[model samples]
Target: MAFPKELYNAKFVEYIESLKILYLVDDKFKVICDDYCSSKMKTEKYKKKFEKYFQHKLEFENLSKELEDEILIYLIRKG
Candidate 1:
């Protein structure tokens, strides 16, 4: 199933916004995530210029249904 357009768009922006800011480039800003999302370009292409910001490497966490108590409930109710 495809993601809902509104929610998908929001999730996309939110995901990028969560990236750690490495530095500001003139009027533009730079950031890096745990991994690349796609070939599409969002932030101005300072990809190479920006280095990884976080010191702690990512540890995998398998998401579970029971753990999503409130917020997921809220979204489900909202939907």
Candidate 2:
């Protein structure tokens, strides 16, 4: 499958190839990617709406970061 636009994030750029591979073969990784994309989209929407001080936005941002870290760790470990 084609990479989803929602999964395009600067932080994940370096891991694009690995992500694509894992996305196709690993169910858990796919879910993580989906959740990461969702959190990123929500974070952007909240940022636009609240401009930086919204609690929900912060929460989403934090979740996005945590998910990102998880992805990085998983990729590194898989290597």
- The per-candidate count of clashes, in order, stands at 0, 0
Clashing pairs in 2: none
Model 2 scores a TM of 0.54
* All candidates: TM-score: 0.15, 0.54
1-79: candidate 2 lDDT, tens digit per residue = 7677876668879998898899999999999888887888898898788865686878999999999999999999999
Q: After superposition, how far is residue 53 of candidate 1 from its true place, in Å?
A: 26
For 1-79, candidate 1 gives per-residue lDDT tens digits of 2222332345467663332233223223232221232333434245533433221222212234445666688999999
* RMSD of candidates 1 onward, in order: 20.6, 22.0
lDDT of all predictions: 0.38, 0.86
lDDT of 1: 0.38
Error of 2 at 33 (Å): 0.5
For model 2 the local lDDT of residue 13 reads: 92
Model 2 residue 69 lDDT score? 100
Q: Report the lDDT of model 1 for residue 2.
A: 28
